[model samples]
Target: MGPDIRTQSLTKPVTVAEYLFTRIHQLGIRSIHGLPGDFNLIALDYIPKTGLKWVGSVNELNAAYAADGYARCLGIGALITTFGVGELSALNGVAGAYSEHVPVIHIVGCPSTVSQRNGMLLHHTLGNGDFNVFSKMSSEVAVDVARLNKPSEIADQIDHALHECWVRSRPVYIMLPTDMVTKKVEGARLADLIDLNEAPNDPEREDYVVDVVLKYLHAAKSPVILVDACAIRHRVVEEVRALVAKTKIPAFVTPMGKGAVDETSPEYGGVYAGSGSQDAVRERVESADLVLSVGALKSDFNTAGFSYHTSQLNSIDFHSTHCTVRYSEYPGVTMRGVLRKVAERVDLKKLTRVESPAVKNEVKKNYEDSKTITQAWFWPRVGEYLQEGDIVVTETGTSNFGIWETRFPSGVTGVTQVFWGSIGWSVGATQGAALAAKDLGTTKRTVLFVGDGSFQLSCQEVSTMIKHGLDVTIFLIYNEGFTIERWIHGMEAEYNDIAKWKYTEVPEVFGPSPKQVKKFIIKTKEELEKLLKDKQFNAAKGLQFVELWMEKEDAPRALKLTAEMSAKHNVRLED
Candidate 1:
């Protein structure tokens, strides 16, 4: 990661692509995901040279999604695409990262500067001779856009963009012209790594906010801590855990915050998603005397179609940019500093401790004897099969909502597009998560639960995963249609139906594995249980695929509740 070395001494100059990738390598990004094209082929050559692995994806869109998932696991991720068509295809995935506050660097390669300035008709252009349209579109979703047009300012632009991407935990765009890829830059610049530390909160404001939070926290008779997604994105999981433990109050998680808190804790309450939650969880959260909201991103789906009844007056919200103690807001006071201070300064003796409600992932016996798998039984059953070090990835449809019922082990990591609710995300995300887990050597397995309908969009990434020999387990649920959409809209419409492809043929159609790929089809709960207990399957020595046949109309209780609420809201008259 240091400056270049020659025969006798360190070199002084290097290519722009070399400098860029070297900086990315220092950020702990071992793998770069993207598709190669005429424009980016030259840049791809520099990736391996910088001691980074190049993951050639099936398409630009999957590459972007893979980058997002990789960022969630490894803290930051990067992807490269070529020119207008490639960049346009990756926009939706990048927008999801922006919506969820994931840090991803999107680098797009374009035609030469001479070609752009002369308004030459490029193959991917719209025939209007405009080269800035795609970049302008990306600006909407990216926190910062860095164009490497000037040789002198390129280093600063790249540094600033990467800095913003990390500190803000959102996507950033970097445009590299073909000619700029080979342009010379000072090698000495690589010696000094870019500053990626988060900005500190103002001491005066932080202390004041902490005092206000303590004032309310000490007076409450029955207070509970509510955790959400931004706690993970802002790198404050430790602080959140510290406060929860030191305060000895019951802590709960939202759907998007499943992996933020340890479920094995004695004070850990079940998930709270308004009307979608279980009766006990809903009553416990809504009836709390004071709610310590940690990094809450209250999207409609996350809140069960905005059914949450907790008023702003009784809640104290902690955000990365501001801290809200009831009606008073303190700007420049972040949660990381204030949470730690409160945990250190507060007197737990004066606080009331409410016992966490009894919560367990117990499978109901009603469907225990059923022939076919129902969502009611399947999700809870999965809890028994999941291991501690597993990374569970879910699609935006059934799996996202269904996972609310599956109690995970202590060290598990959950990945889902809850806020964005984009279909077919789990397939690509599973691949990225597998690679990230493998890279970090921190997880035992990466598994995905995707619907048969949503699996059609980015299924080709399974080939990319196979090529990399990623040890992934895929659970393809065959239900004949988008059951989630049926719950929200037309139930019997043909538009909701999907082709019943031979899903077991994926390994044969895609590249044959470096290691043997195993496939299975289970129609009954007995078969699924047998497969789950199989030692070979649990080992996850290689890629494994399972096709589970289930009833179409049935869904998880959480999705059923939220979809019905969403259906009524969809037809509401304009206010």
Candidate 2:
């Protein structure tokens, strides 16, 4: 059904750029995101020949963000940027990908090998002879780094970097020199798919780990499965669902793991974020005698500021590279394989099944009867507006905390940068997410909730979305400043404030024709309610922008709690 590497020509001599792009294209990268610079312009010419679309972004950082979102949806994505300045500018986005475990191939076009060898000063360089500084900086964030200087090793370097990206599910860096772009190389390696498979582990060790886990699982009267962000990053969502189904165990998800499993399943409990968790969810997970944690990521934000109370001795942790049962750890036990084995070997009849507690919907009422929009009332209302198959993108501040209160319907994908905490990620991410949804032939709308302060950082990417006529609905929360920062340390500091813009006029200013885009401003609940019911708004055709006016001091309850915890941690003295 797919391209067969065995039948492909083995002796053909293809340009190095062709080989590299062809390998990437074969890996399902339909679109590559980046801005064109002089060093990379020649390499860009080969993109079309490989049947991959060049999504020219407005800036390097936005390009990287777009690629990150695309990779999350498509499993693997690529970004091409030119030397020093371009790569450095994109580092923050790559760091976020590293933190979140997104598989993005970052290809940088550098100066010719001769230029580097002669130590010639280049415009994009640091003006000194050192060209390795940038690559060294990239090494800190990337899982693997390869600089292709010799034509002979080009295929191996590219293949290794690409394979590392797929197997580790993290961003990898590859530097392509300008002169090396078109250098002819042997195309024999193209006959076989890159070996992205995980190496086999010790069978005895895996069996011992599974037996130890089963021992605890069978002896406990109450056992709950906790699915976190790593399940999605390691490509084990199906395995997690299968395990839950086979064992009939009650399951709960962390904030980062929100959409990995079908939230609408009967065994699915709500989010578990320690103190920030819903009452019933916190009780169900924390009180369990044995907890099976699959790909759990316990970041401070995800765990309500490191407030998790679960005992490590009672928890069995399953990771991408290893598995841990109580105090014993089994290295090289792949989570996918181990989870499958556990699901197959787990006897549902011998284990006790407890019904998940009913999720409570506590609606906060405005006793003062104020007409203003509030986070408490707004987030719950958003739950009612969401439909199946919608991809929800929440920004780092208020939107992130707000969405935690809203339960997603089945087939919904929630994208956020909690661990990395990048502010402007959602704006650029929406572009790639919408494109990915279109490429997958899904009839889903991309819904983005971003703060006004965060939106300004990468707001120009909306023009890219409009250029491609993407179906995106943007809900911009206009709170007059960085409300999250204010809650954290500076309550009324001037540094926390931002310049005000006519948020509704953004689309028109960005070159979108009036009829091609829709804009709305809602200061009260009635307007928001009326807008949600509007058929044109729900269709999400073209680019839809809604500016929601709210108070600067107002924040979601969860944010308040976490902010206080963060402040306490910041002031703590060393022992």
Candidate 3:
């Protein structure tokens, strides 16, 4: 073996593009999504040959969203696209993913160094000789923004991007110039890594706060845990569940954290801040003696605009930035470690008498009742229509309402871009999710409930669907505008309204193989029923698009309640 070393000598050194591709592989990226362009030719050439799957999208925006959905299921998401136009189009999705704490690696290809120096207007540019659009948006959305100015910066920038993802729990951006792709430089480490470092709390404050929290929990006759999206984003679900179990507290989760604890838990009361919530659940939360808000954001929608109708008697607020006790002059240490320590001291026998079989029954009853509302009614019906194994991706609008109302059967899964609440995300994300489901060998169907406005923004993904021959169901809620915005801000008759589509004609417009693509126009509830009952609709092989015409004036449960509550307080709303 030693004698054969010289005979089996290695070939010539690889280019920077080869090295970068190798690094991306080491980062555990299953696929790279985006459209190819002149500027990014080098990375594009290296991508497929290096063994990374290329999930090419029809456009940059859809590519970015697909990457986001992929990242949501699989830890890290990545997208590769050309300079200015491509990167700019993708910025919104990246920003949304960042806000929601989705880890995404953005590989943008820019013009060659010589062209940039000459100040030439590149393709996808706004007549300006710069490809800095993402840089501008990242000023607001990204946790960290680093430009790979030199070839030497690539390894470090990638490392920094991953670090930002772990520490800040958000998206990070890395810009790669076309000129730098094959440039020679010293490469650092070839992969990303994250290690947890336990930092000590301020001893004086930690002790005081721990004592107060313990006394409050021990003395309280009724204590409950309130979990939110923050808990999920922080990866603290186990920690929070441990705390709840130790304290023997009944747990009520925010709408976003619906699945944090099993819906079947004996101590679980259904979610408290969404369409499914009942007046009784509201009353229960408002009356509890000790409310441990573990990683709660208290968003306007979640808190009913912070009305404080909930029991303010002994509120323990735990947020990433601050921690405070009710009516306390001095604040306590952050919930970061205090929660774990608190969980360690709990008495599990402190179970409350409130845990009744009735609560569990009510969860089922509430789901049925919620289906009457405009937002939720669709999903319940859609659920009946769904096959045994299906993946439903919901957009940010009436589509989300439908998913919220629809219960997932044991083998089905649901996804939403809930963290950022960005409109037009579902259509693009659905393509990505479906692609993922296909790769996993799950014979489940992939379905999307997207809004008219959202579809208009990212509809180009239809081409990708056609190209891949993916069997996906796309339901476009044709409300003609940003339905959720209209409900929230009452910007009725504004530009938020969308132009209608001959929805059932989409596949025809895109050129269809009827086996792989079909479209439906459903106007009334009865029409929807007929569509759902039609076995052919579910069994059709290509891309099936269902255009459901929703009432433009339909109001969601939360919106209707908020309006009523506001009127009761005489809060003025602009017409």
Question: If the candidates were sorted by their lDDT against the true structure, best first, what order would they fall in?
Answer: 1, 2, 3
Tell me the TM-score of model 3. 0.79
The model with the greatest TM-score is 1
Alpha-carbon TM-score of each model against the true structure:
0.97, 0.96, 0.79
List per-prediction Cα lDDT, in the order shown: 0.89, 0.88, 0.67
**How well is each residue in 503-541 modelled by candidate 1, as lDDT tens digits?**
988777886854668999999988988999999899886
The full ranking of all candidates by TM-score, starting with the best, is 1, 2, 3
Error of 1 at 150 (Å): 0.4
Model 1 whole-model lDDT (C-alpha atoms)? 0.89
Q: Which pairs clash inside model 3?
A: 480-498, 515-542, 516-542, 516-543
Give lDDT tens digits, candidate 2, residues 289-322. Answer: 9999989888989888998989998899999988
The segments of candidate 2 whose C-alpha lies over 4 angstroms from its true place after superposition are 1-10, 360-369
